[model samples]
Target: MSRKTLLRAGPLWQGGVSPYGLIEDPGAGGLALPAGFGGRVVARSGRKVAGLTWHAAPDGGACFPDGTGWIYVSNSALPLVGGASALRFRADGSIGDAYRILSGTELNRAGGATPWHTWLSCELGHRGRVFECDPYGTRAARPRLAMGRFKHEAAACDPDRQVVYLTEGERDGCFYRFRPGDWGDLTEGALEVLCASGGWEPVPSPAALLKGTRHQVRGARRFDGGDACHYTGGVCFFTTRGDGVLWAYDARTSALERVCDGVLAITSAPSGDLYVATREARVDVITPERAVAPFLRLDRPSGAELTGLAFAPGGGRLYFSARRGRTGGETFEVAGPFRGAWAR
Candidate 1:
């Protein structure tokens, strides 16, 4: 008895535009889609362009296999001049061709996508760093710095154990796992900083009690943000906002489990299931024993804030991203079959 799909509230573009990007709903029951659904912007951010402002801070977006559309802006506050840029959208959403990649690094925001496809860009700034572009934009993008560069916010890869799952966008954040030893090669890794020794029950603070403490960020560092995914057995989830916990770094025994608390932005479900986005705008579904509940409920207008999330491979559809006051952002599409259905 698992079948309840109904989510359709399309087209709503206010002054700030709104919608960061999210996907899921290639067809049947995963349901979710918003972020240029059919496209048609071609390109934007006019005016002399220093970093192409409208305030600039578009934050994480991806969709390709041939559909083409990639976005990642940053300049919420930095040396600006490409503190973090990378835009390319054309499925009609317009805006194409803009690649600075990573500059002085300050706000970069949500980034992840690497089964070897490259594009890890993170930097929420306090001392954040995590760059690895190459989605065809040539090369020259550095900073793995052994992976301990702080403030980074979303990264996940595990091509059968190549391993990489990092998220720390501070408010007391820490949850990492990098095992390059020779796996898929991210230079040559062995960076592990996750430590929640026993099973569960921690959450005291100091960044969720720093799970097991083995951290390392001497010298160069900035913003240890959050937002990550790579579920199922190899496990590698992420999300942190002082108390919105949802860690889970287990590449087998690297350990760091906080399972699911509050949640803020996580994506998965080609059947793997695990879609969370909640500052309370809702969107939850964790279960497999962990238990969560509510699946989708977004009306937003009051304060408005819903970061990125994706899952559009061949399921019901679920994609998200939005921002409303502080600088006003945009990206939306929501069509789902959401509301609890897990029994595997």
Candidate 2:
């Protein structure tokens, strides 16, 4: 099947305004053919400026159809305390109306959409939590305290096996899976933290002594609020920044195993392949056999911090967001030349 590659370019909005930096690589071309990619200013939020630490981060976004011929993106605007906003974009790259999903949450990072069409926004701070927001903007947002939230990063939902996988974004975070008591309705489900043993295990405190080896526990103290998905069968993966370890939560045996380390973000491809993004502006393909290799490296300079990664619907292309230098941000679309093939 032939894949369609549609590129939309515009300037990213910061501080409720357009920074309007150079979009294309000036050295590569005359900036006339749109050498790299252009970014469109979607929406701006400046009402509560006093509460925000910085301008709209717009860190992570996912593409989803919104009844009309447009796609909606749940953007993580504020870093730690500000809420996330949902913005719709047209096929022509025009920005649409913006809606507030959840407010007063900590560090709304990159979250994945549930199979049921709800957005699971994760907090990236020490007091992180997850909230489910309706894309239609008619439902009240609530936190799933049973999920044991603590500095969450991203979440992916399987929807087929009725399991929602979650990621913790801490120095030595743990991967978690929430098996809701009822799959039909997510609001009233029993949330269980992934455990190695049959019961709860204590997570060590920050001051706990650790000399050489790492300790694996069954359960940590529940945060009464965390970010997660209500979708079923989603793969649960988490990243630990200190050692750069990625762990996959096993649903069948309730055990966490090392899947991939030295990566920043993990997203499952439509072909069941896992794509891991590193902070070094490179992405790797992790295979079923646990082999790791490079897929693509951004052509930008070294200061480009690759923050968010998401696969376009149908898995034809991969998209990543990067903040280059001090004030510029760009999203790159890599054409999938090799289908079902993992790269470096």
Candidate 3:
């Protein structure tokens, strides 16, 4: 069956009744957040937090629950020195530990968290690859070479389907899915590209020895600057930064639809609301009712882009980063009642 592609148009966010009240002016750390919400710097480039120095060019990030508190992993996007670091938070929201998880990677960008508690840190470039990282800093990070080598952006693992959906960062990139030889194992897999004629086709060579993975498969649908992906409720959502379009792929029917426009990175709250970071230094929310509204905004550091949106366990605080800020790369946390119901 052929898939339906929907197109939408609008500003950063459409008006609607937001669960959170009006956003306050730039407060601490130049953050304009909803009432009852406050922001603080968790880490800054070249700065030390909880004794461990934070990584530079903070990109993709995610939170993992520990015994009583949680762990937040952030990726570094520097070419040669790029790696991933983690920060452990106590139950009282205090830093307990900080350390590096993955090291010696290149241009690490936005990545997704695996259901098995691993962080899929993606490298950005023609020779980019995906590295599976242990957020707890116990096991060693491994490179999943079978996932295909290309300019990777974000990855979304569908545990039910036993497959991992990935987005490429090229101007003419292809959405891909990798089916590992076995569930919970990334040792080997078959890389398939989404075809415009419907269904998926396996790429002849994932290594791209002579041809790029996106160009290896014929009739493959090309996404403009694919970035930021999330899978939930049998739907895989991804974004294309080039055209500023958000897409939803239905796993059951293999159908694709345009959800909205103008967003970069996205993360879902415990209330099932989607929070998207915008290029204009703002974060917006799409309610379960499909209503869109502004959630938070960053005031200073004009031209800085927002990314790495993640929520800590219990949904009490949200963490994100500005890859390029006025002072430098900075990761922040916004604490509020994110698990509350939407306004009627």
Candidate 4:
């Protein structure tokens, strides 16, 4: 999606070496990566990076292109102190600045990046909501009440459909779709829940005044513990930890298929591989060919789960956060040739 070459859906490397050839020894940060790749702890909670303290319990994250470098925004899932923060990188990949983008939100967890470049940070409890924040930190974050109120996990914007698909984290959570009157405007939208028949029914009470949004729609399908979401190549991919299933919704056919098992946070690579941070302390890559393999493993010091997963602008660098690291929480960067690996 960043103007990089897309990995074909067919067999990769054609009797050649895989991009993830062989994992090298663990780095100083305890992350095992493939050869030609390196990892380092970029930031930690209770510590400062670029003069600003990194938020604790870093959960969901996304990367946006800046003038030459990029900005990485991560949501803090610590209750009552939850918010989202951003780190701006200079062209040389050094920290240019770090600041808060969305403050005062509670239990901010996984969210998706909008095609317009805004980050949709979702709150993670019964009273949760979606906050559209400017990744650049220039504009104040705005809460979109029209997106409905529920225990939200993540959101994925399908530019072609002009709709935003949201995942709920409840045990019996419902997959939701929001259709805005205008493409980029999220202020007013028709919130609908997905039905088992592939049809959508308007949410009787998006505010959930009478009951929970999931229950308001009589026939709305329930997803177990929906987690991270990502949209790419006409499909919307999401994960459910309750059942450990990775789901793919074909936008064109309006069909849902189970792609894999074991998931947490998910991000798509420019090469068409879906990198998923599992409930386990590792990240797996689901290639376009449907072959799944371990991409990276963390010798988690705090026995924490992997949460955030996002690729830098060119997809050469990957950024993810350990929900609870040695320093309470930590964000790590893995640099390799993931983007242009096919041509090697």
Give lDDT tens digits, candidate 2, residues 1-344: 12111111232121121111222343321111122332222332333322332225555556565553334454454655556655454443444555666777756766777777777777776555667777667787777654444666677765556756666654444445556677634554433344435343333321123420013353442222222222222335555556665555444444545544466666656545566677666666654434455555565545565555655555544555565543345544454343543330
**What lDDT tens digits, residue by residue, belong to model 1 across residues 189-231?**
5665544342222112222234322233322122234555444
Model 3, 11-114: lDDT tens digits are 33469878887888888678898888888988888989989888888989999989888999998888888989999998888889999999988889889999
Winner by lDDT: 3
Model 2, poorest ten-residue lDDT window?
1-10
Clashing pairs in 3: none
For every candidate in turn, the CA RMSD to the true structure comes to 18.0, 10.7, 4.0, 3.3
For model 4, how does the per-residue alpha-carbon lDDT over 1-344 read when each residue is reduced to its tens digit?
63221233443332233458766778787898888888888899889999999989899999998988899999999887798999998877788999999988888989989989999999987769999999998999999989999999999999988999999999999999999999899999899999988999999788887799998878889899888888888888888979988888888788888766777778888777778887778887766655667788898564878877998887888999987742378899888778443211
lDDT, model 3? 0.86
Please report, as a residue range, the 10-residue window in candidate 4 with the lowest summed lDDT: 3-12
List clash counts for every candidate, in order.
57, 24, 0, 0
Ranking 1 against 2 by TM-score, winner: 2
Worst 10-residue lDDT window for candidate 1 reads 1-10
The order of the candidates by TM-score, greatest first, is 3, 4, 2, 1
Q: Tell me the TM-score of model 3.
A: 0.94
Error of 1 at 114 (Å): 28
In Å, residue 66's CA in model 3 sits off its true spot by 0.8
Using Cα atoms with residue i matched to residue i, what is each candidate's TM-score against the true structure?
0.28, 0.64, 0.94, 0.93
